[model samples]
Target: MELEVYTYQFLRRRSRISSSRRRKSRSISPRRLKSRSPTPKRHKRRKSRDSMSLVSESSSASGGPKENKDDSEILKIEEENKKRRQQEAELKLIEEETAKRVEAAMRKKVDESLNAENIKLEIQKRLEEGRKKLLVEVDAQLEREKEAALIES
Candidate 1:
């Protein structure tokens, strides 16, 4: 009985130690893990900015013209890219202005067509009214002539 109790207590203590270790590991932040890790690629990327000046200095020490040529080429390329961007922006603006002008012209044409249709309808209405007035006047004249002829006879 004594041996069995001691064995159970030992097992419980071992489990408790393992659980505490797991809690500690879970509580550790990512920053601590990154600091512990060896990331050579990240270090290389950070060193490249310093390396560019070293390369230029080495080229100058060697008395080479390549460095100046490379710099001029890079500047030329950057200028060309800037010019292309400006041209593209100008073209986009022109296209937008043209689209606006076309839209305005279309709207004006539609308005003019509508106005013309309205004028035509108004003219037709006036002609119809004039025809009715003319028929009434002719009927009154015929009636007056008939009464005059009857009185004379």
Candidate 2:
């Protein structure tokens, strides 16, 4: 009876899977698909510097190229900006040099502390600490052994 019920369920599932409800597994391949983007690239127009010239009628007005008021203002602003940048660079250099000097002094202090005499003193201190810890541990172990001996007796 159980076999018949299971076979009926299996047959129904197989029929459902084989019917229009079947899902086709797509197989992936190592190939690129055609993009065919909607918007095409636009053609850009380029101008050459060789064909450019000053529009002013007189070229000797300022002994140089004729620049408009806005251009002159921009040039002045650029000069001011350049000067400011130079000052900032100089300040940064001074700060860096000061930092380097401070760092060198700090490194020298560290080197001095790590000298042979200081290193020997540091090692002696660590050895003393280790000896103290060892003595405490040994005392604790001796106390434990003494307690065990008394209990055994």
Candidate 3:
């Protein structure tokens, strides 16, 4: 009887120790959970700022004559920019045309110079060839005359 009573008390003490450990692991307070939620709070603040900026922009667009005037001014500036671009294009075309004329004139002068040089070289070669042919013909005629004189004498 005494041993059974001691075993029962020991089992109860073991169960109490385990239950205390479980309680310690699972004990979370609502205040601690709320403190952990501030990260999401900060994200909500950022979202609110974005939404407020959108609302303000929408409200301002829904207001009076300032928006119309601003759009017209923007359109006018675009027209002026288009005109300037057209003028620049025209200037570029004129410059290109002038450059083409200058290049053509330069090419003509170079061609004339090359033609003159080629003509001079051809005339010199022809004159040399004619002189050589004349010498050869004269030599042949002299040999023929000598042979004829010898035959006659």
Candidate 4:
């Protein structure tokens, strides 16, 4: 009666038995909602009622085509499962993207700090070299002045 879409998620394994039978059976089979497990007599009474319903269905089947009630339930369960899987997949993708963004931010912060430390070390090295050159020049100037004073005397 209706068309369905195909997806890779449906390609994976699925349960042979549909859980919707128990999950939504209240709508499909109301009589099953009430249980009389503690009382055997009530259980037997329910079984008899079930048998009577089956007998009527069998007679109707003989008179005409049997209704595909079970088939509709199976379709509904399949759709429910697919929708749940799609939502879960979307959530997983979102989580992975967030984690990647955090990792990239952390890497950028570490690289920035490392570059700052390297620049500080380079400035200190240049300043030390300049101080050494000035000390050497001052020592040469003092020796020249002393020689001049001795020659004049």
Looking at model 1, the pairs that clash are none
lDDT of 1 at 78: 99
Could you tell me the TM-score of candidate 1?
0.37
| Cα lDDT tens digits for candidate 2, 89-127 | 999999999999999999999888888797979889999
Better of 1 and 2 by lDDT: 1
Question: What's the distance in Å from true for residue 123, model 3?
Answer: 10
TM-score of each: 0.37, 0.44, 0.36, 0.34
Worst 10 residues of 2 by lDDT: 41-50
Name the best candidate (by TM-score): 2
Task: Give a tens-digit lDDT track for model 3, residues 25-76.
Answer: 2324322433335468768998897987776676567454576577778889
Taken over the whole model, the C-alpha lDDT of each candidate is: 0.75, 0.68, 0.75, 0.67
- Candidate 3 CA-lDDT value: 0.75
After superposing candidate 2 on the true structure, give the runs of residues whose Cα lies further than 4 Å from its correct spot.
1-67, 116-119, 145-153
**Residue 128 of model 4, lDDT score:** 96
Output the better candidate (3/4) by lDDT. Answer: 3
lDDT of 2 at 33: 27
